[model samples]
Target: MTIRSRLLLTAAIGMAQPALAEVTLTRGSSPVPDGEALSTGDLTVQNEHLAFTIAVDSQAPWGVPRGAIVDLAPVTDGEIALDRIAFADFIPNNWSAWPNTGREVEIVTETPEKVVIRITRDFGEADIATTYTLEEGSDRIHLVTEMTNRGDVPLVDQMSGFTLWPDSGYILPVPGLAGVDSGSAEDALSDRVVAYDEDWFIALHAPYFDRVEYASKDLYATHTLAPGETRSFEGWLQVGPSGDLAPVVAAEIARGDIAAGSLAGQIASTSGPVEDSVLVVEKEGVPYIWTLTPDGSYEIDLPAGDYSVYATAAGYSDSAPQQVTVAADGSETLGFEDLKAPGLLDFAVTDSAGEPLDARITITEGQAPLVEFLGRQTFFTELDQVGGVQASIAPGDYVFTVGHGTGFLTEGEEVSVSVASDETQEVDVALELIARPYENDWYASDMHHHADQLEGTTPPEYVARSELAAGLDVIFLSDHDSTANHGALAEIAEMRGVPFIPSAEFSPSWGHFNAYPLSLGEPLEIDTSTATAAEVMAEARRLGADAIQVNHPFIPYGYLASLEAGTVPGGFAPDFDLLEMNGPDDDDAVFARAAQFWTQGQRIFLSAGSDAHDVWNDNTGSARAYVHVPGGVSADGFVANLKAGRAYVTRGPLIEPEIMFGTELRIAPDEERSLSFDLTAVNGLATASLIGPDGEISSQSFDKAPSTATAEFSITATPRTEGEDWVALRVEDTAGKTAYSDPIWINPLGEPDVLSQD
Candidate 1:
């Protein structure tokens, strides 16, 4: 007999009952209480090795119990672990939103071998029924779910699965899975299953690692259910201690019988033919990988079963999955072709002088964005293993929008292109580089960024290349709490002729700060490194940071904000030189908080960064600081200029405001100043304000239309009562983009210049 059959017979003989055991189901308070969330139901199930409480609770979404606290622990001689595993009734795609746990939970059957519990939740147009069977002898649970669509419309691409969190341990991917990290909290996506091990191992028979919640990993499957039809699927979870996974994996391999079958497909591409493309074949929810032929055709040998097949490539829109079924044992052929293809978008960017210019491109159809490449300065015209600006786009009518940064300005062009099947269209974009007041001396920099940190493995060379592509004059390699790749990236930066700033992100629970001129030999730990923010800031200063900038001060755990709430140990703020006022997107709250601190007499310089991780998905220098490095651009020189407060941070809009007096930009008390402003933007300016210690002293509205891309302003102003009253220029474009200049301080009427100026 098979091992499973033999074990079943033994278990039946030892534990069989004369009749079904009486199961008394009841609703009670939460078994594992954490907060003020309302409880739905509590269930207790015990076996020789495990005792778990399935507590249902309502949190986040209203009127629904979405959280399933699987308070599970190992039981030894009736004793259980203090820590328990808690999870929720989470669907992989619904990790962000809480999924509804049915209005009622009931125990339908109870026996020595199994306990079957049924849960039903009513949707507005449909309802879902999930039955969980907790079996004896093993910690594995069988989940059989059925969803009936009662509405007229058929539901498509529905993802449903459990979100589980084990108390401890990381998830190991399945063998031979061809996928990368999903870039969420989840560590990875596997082809067949994911295993979690702490003191014991729990294997989930699901294909995708959806996300991570605290210490737990979410595993799920995707399906489509037609209206008035019932769709059903089975999921399994097996558990054991240490060396017990061999049999489990062996059993699963046996269950998935190897069948002889062949798959054929062709990729439709307008750019001659698709090469180096991939065809993903998911069999019974497990993804199997295969490479496509050079002419966009593919053939695969797969096990006999049902499969969902799709095609994918870089810069191409993903194709819809085609369902196919194969016969077991016999040679069968399945065809998945005649699908719509993606077109090729080959474009180049340059300045009016025929020199490459860093720019951002957006391809959109009506209101839907197709492909977007932000902060792209250099274009690679050659084709090789690694890709360039060339994109394989979906066939459609798209509007191409392009904009430049810093020394370059373009009203932002919009060209309409109709992409047809199997065609390569080449387009050229030329942006005009305007010579501002300090044109030859200014250098743009993004001080905060990350790569290959937990989520991705973006290499050091790619990092340097991304910086050049974004047209950044300088980039600081500040991976979170680690400077592992600083030296390697610095070498690449040197090769690319860009200044590299060696830095580390002291990302602590209380706050995050960047330390420059990083010493790699020094020890740094995420936990137990520094107890308080004060000590961490002190450590950064000791590490030779010319000036420490508070990162994202308005976000959660942001230093200045956390300090205000007294969350950090120290009551007083740290002695930092700069404040990050900009990131990928504009946050008015961050700018307001920084301005409040400065207006309250704090000496702070403003800075900006893209905070980009994956350059393919993000824009480098979407927001950047332009430092006036008149002494020539060097890492030390740039840091010195930042410390001297001779810089302005901008997003899209370009503004050059100057107070023509001394090179130091200083004036005596009540001194008259002749100010000149040269501003140009893809979106014209709305208003320009001159802010002082007591708030706005004067403001001017540009007379040009909101769409006007360029303008200049020159006006004179005088300091009223100069006791540390600093004057700064702030401008806003019609599109709500902003730029901020460093403040020029007016010395007190009788006081002498205070500290040594940069």
Candidate 2:
């Protein structure tokens, strides 16, 4: 039977008596073989609201190929005009869609009210069963997707659910792509995964309150599943006219049908009030975490069922997760009174001038990170705001590594303090600021940063001091689509003698970009998740943005490759100035891609950022852009220098490339017979390579450690058969610290080169 005729039948029956209508499911085989489709076959589901086909092909029965959601629109009119490339499934790792290889599907049950189908692969090693149900007289379908591990190996980084790729012209309620650990109905309600398209509205309801992520045209959920365990997700997809969905969301919340429950608990082992304790609950191999107030009590809004709960603090040993059960909407109060006590360690840092200096610190237990806090803010640990460092740590020997950013170096110190239940210890360290080759004029800046804006977050003033403590001369609070903190941050930067550049991270539907030097008003008139990359760049320029940078292009929705692919409508490879070379982790792929674009004659500049959101956990300016503003550092000077390509990005080692002939820094090809630049580093260096034309043409390695090195090469005046050639340098020190210089154009001899675009 055809799906349209089945939908018409359901609608006719439901018109007589709303609640009397029942869902009907039909099984059929595609043109492809059964093994290629879902093992059992494909299933067609239809109701008044929408009609779609679920394919359980063996290649990956769990994955929904393009056009899975065949139809969706208001219940009255026939299916609205929209893209049919909607898919669903469980992704085990990153953003790449799961192929569901070596998997098969089984039809568990078929009824009017619900249809349950299980998709499994690897000879029953893993299984995910999804039940689709439709209510009479309603424009929504309830989906309950559950995944279980039947194999001996544990399922790592397993994230499951559906992603609907509807047509554009919709708005995401939130700024970013995802939200983690949404606790209350109001909290989840504020960030509804609903998209409004003219007269129609499509929404994804998370009744039980879990981690939900949605783009302009996509919706999905993620969680890990373990061996012999199952992780279930409950939500509803509502499609109807544009109006209030509060009632639908509220009803779902009250139903308490979601997978997890609420866990309320308290911290009991601290000496005083339990300020700043983290509660972690792991259920079915999925962990839900919450940060509680410094007070003695806490609450876990959504606790996965049959989970273990624990508490952890800076210096205290983590309390093992105790197994507990929490019912939906029901609460379970738990406590941690036996958490291992920790010795208090205090720090006092100073500069060579005997003055206090805020220092970036790393406290390691053995060699691993002692504490890595999560929940979307800054993660680097710094002592600038607190004016000192203090920790409550388990009584054990640890190494306290300290260094002032860029200009100073301080060695690590071994600390051993024993405490009997309660005791305090103190330590002191001084970082000596050594003279560098370019400290006189070059200034460092962390161009991308975010502060705690959710609730009870540190003020922007404190964050400003943290930037200063990290030895940053300039800072840009490029919060996600909001400049609410920039005003206060600018004031604080003034007082702290640091230049604050006003900027916002333009989150276009295609990718993320950062626009700088914004004006005070109702924010930029650009909705990144809905607008195209070209439209976003045009809008930024119209709004007087001095520059726009592509941020973290290696991330999930990075625009570089997407634009090249032309997958997103209205998206094109717009000419953007600076490309981000640094993020939370190292991505050589992004760096390599940027180089490929540059070598292909795209006039791209290089920039780096710490991407620091949490000051205490993230190094504010770990990866910084050193801009050479020879005259003085001003707002305009900073931006102009960057646009002019007078900058180099660095993490630890310092690299500067100077194309010199006689006394000139920039030489014309007619005068570029030979050029040389001195590469200097504070650390012992081993090798330096000069990159040009085809690739690394020349390289030098040092037998003995040298504080400085030089690379010289002859520039050819030959006419090239390809695009323009360029030159740059990459240097690495004995400590493995490396830096890449901004590329300098090696123009063809006698060719008239346009130096500036503006």
Candidate 3:
């Protein structure tokens, strides 16, 4: 069936019940006969005769291609195995849609978030699949597949599956998944199996996670499907021998994220009113025309033969799929089944000027059943050029609203429409001025990054330039005990018009929390070879800087130091800002611990940063801080916000918080008060709440569901009456984004002894 029918089915079923669509595929049936399929095919070593590669054998019936499982180049005396070939009795399903020739599995059953393919296996069919390996010659890369026929009569099974080896580097073409690669020398934690591109670069993302074990040198990653099932996928994977897959790949292949592939060979067609080239046809989906006021047609290609077509658009009733016959190399004329353009809902959004507002515009459906359309990308629709944009929607009535700044929309503006499929619905939009969404919102930031001074950029430049371009509101010039870029960036930020925080990544020769922000030239004065974290943080605070956090508290290197040890540190530098949440540096356990730290109130803020730096921008700026300044676009405002603790950091999401006792400035922690503020979001949905000064204190959750929401959170904080009063909120989104509000300055009912001042 075509994707049009599937989307329609989802929409209809969605209105009645909550459900998510899943894809399935049948057992492998041999399509092409296996030839000399050498048990030991080809083998070679490259990369200055360091890495190794060999043709994999077809053994277990799990789905993965027959190629060099390991580059074998990065390691000395590395080995490759060509184990058994056949069907994986263990796979037990048709997760491998095409059973034999080396298929690519972009989304697998393990991590069900992406476009997934699962196999509900039925043992009764004589289904077949294949699995292979080239591990340290371990059995993990081997395949054992078989076909069974249980019947009174003879049953012939023809199974087919494809396996394309991992490439050096690849550009994933999925809607949201981008540049990705795995397998590299820098993979210290060993969380990956089939590394995508090259090697030899220190790249890490989402580090603080659950598990940090080196994915066994002999790792198993495959996908399979069962009988009478179907699977679908888009994009491609580039398999090669030499490239960096060290730290970041746009998308994680995940535990079961088998592989990435191309949509190049899929069958599809496009049609609408007016043969306007403005709308270039993309991919294998049908376009259902609701109102074709002026019908137009386009061309499509199908492997020389009989074909079927389904057309659709929003708000229009789905039409019955049509079957058309075509001759080879032929062009056919197809028009909008119902020729008419949906009434145009066009608008010229502009700044205060009667002139058009030149901000990005997005039209999301506000009439219930909302879906996500934005992530990583800055605009709702592809920004083709400067000023103008046009979009096509189903003629059904819609409440269209547009947003430009990082704030809320001007309430959903309902627009009714009635136009022929061939007609254009023109409702020119005029965006008005509104408050900046992140204004006054607590923004979080991390002051470290390393852009090796080699690849046309340095660590400080990574902290300064690429980060700002990718929307990181704050960054510190923290290099590996190197002050080279801090001074350089301070001047460059001034010349290039960007913000730069002076800092340094001080390491004691031993690998530990190496990042600590400092004044531009601080690194030059410190003897990092002998300094302790306490001494570093002490100097940071002594420099009149605002805050300092213990970076990647869980990463183990020399001394086997843990976050717990760093926290007590002879009580030196005890009072501080945070313990790096280090989302990008975490393994599974690290991520869980980060969450636990927030819930338990570790006495320090939870922060995340991207420890990214590679020849390529792998997960570059994947994790960053979002400091909520006054949205006026000034350095002073940003600095004040940083000192105030109004910030959040993440690979995605935005937030804002405010606290008050009615109108009085005295919203003492000892007294309760009414609190309110706006929460603006993009890229991800999140949960937020108010927390007392104590980290372990129970807080309130957002309470309301936000769909482009401008919500009010009112909670009372009966703060400690004895101590200097302070109340704040902590938030984390479903996507792992974390933020901390700067403690609202509350008048302490009494003063506690500070040992020195008291």
Top candidate, metric TM-score: 2
The residue-by-residue lDDT of candidate 1 on 154-189, one tens digit each, is 767555566544433334444333243332324332
C-alpha local distance difference test of each model: 0.56, 0.55, 0.36
Q: Judging by TM-score, tell me the better candidate of 1 and 2.
A: 2
- For model 2, residues 1-758, the per-residue Cα lDDT tens digits are 32234435766776776443445565654321111233345665555554445554322111222223333444344332332222333332333322232445566667665555554433135665556665545666677766678878887654345544333223334223323322222333223365443345566655333344433223344455667887776766676543323333333433543444455567766465455665655545443223343576775445234766677665566665688876655667888875556666676767777777665565544322112431111222333343366655555456656655633233333343444446787767766664333365777788877664311134576577667667677867776566778778777667656677888776543466778877742366654434556777887777668888888776555667455535344646565888887653544565566568776777677788876654654567767787877777887788878867777776655654454110113334454465565665556667877776577877878768676667566665445688666666677777766666677666555343323222
Better of 1 and 3 by TM-score: 1
lDDT score for candidate 3 against the true structure: 0.36
Cα RMSD for predicted model 3:
18.3
Model 2 lDDT, residue 231, Cα: 73
Off by over 4 Å in 1: 1-336, 340-347, 358-408, 411-427, 434-438, 520-530, 583-602, 660-672, 706-723, 748-758
Q: Assess the local accuracy of residue 160 in candidate 1 as a C-alpha lDDT between 0 and 100.
A: 57
In model 3, what lDDT does residue 497 have? 51
Q: Supply the TM-score for candidate 1.
A: 0.56
Error of 2 at 58 (Å): 40
Q: Per model, how many backbone clashes are there?
A: 7, 26, 164
RMSD of each: 14.6, 15.0, 18.3
Q: What TM-score would every model get versus the actual structure?
A: 0.56, 0.57, 0.40
lDDT of 3 by residue, 1-758 (tens): 33234334755775676323211112232111221123443333222112223333322211222332222223223221221112111222212221222323221422211122222222233333322222221111222333333334433222222222221222222211112232222423222223322221111122111222222112222223344443222111122222322112312322223232211111122333332211112122321111111123333322233444443333232234455554433444443354223333344444344544334333344222111110111123222222344554444444554433322222223334443444565555545443334344433343446654211123444344344433344555555445556677677667655566665554442223433435556544444333454775555666545655556655542212323334222233454554454544453334344344433434344455565543133333455555655454345555444433445454444445444211113433444445554554443346656544344344434444343344344434354434443445555545455544434444433332111110
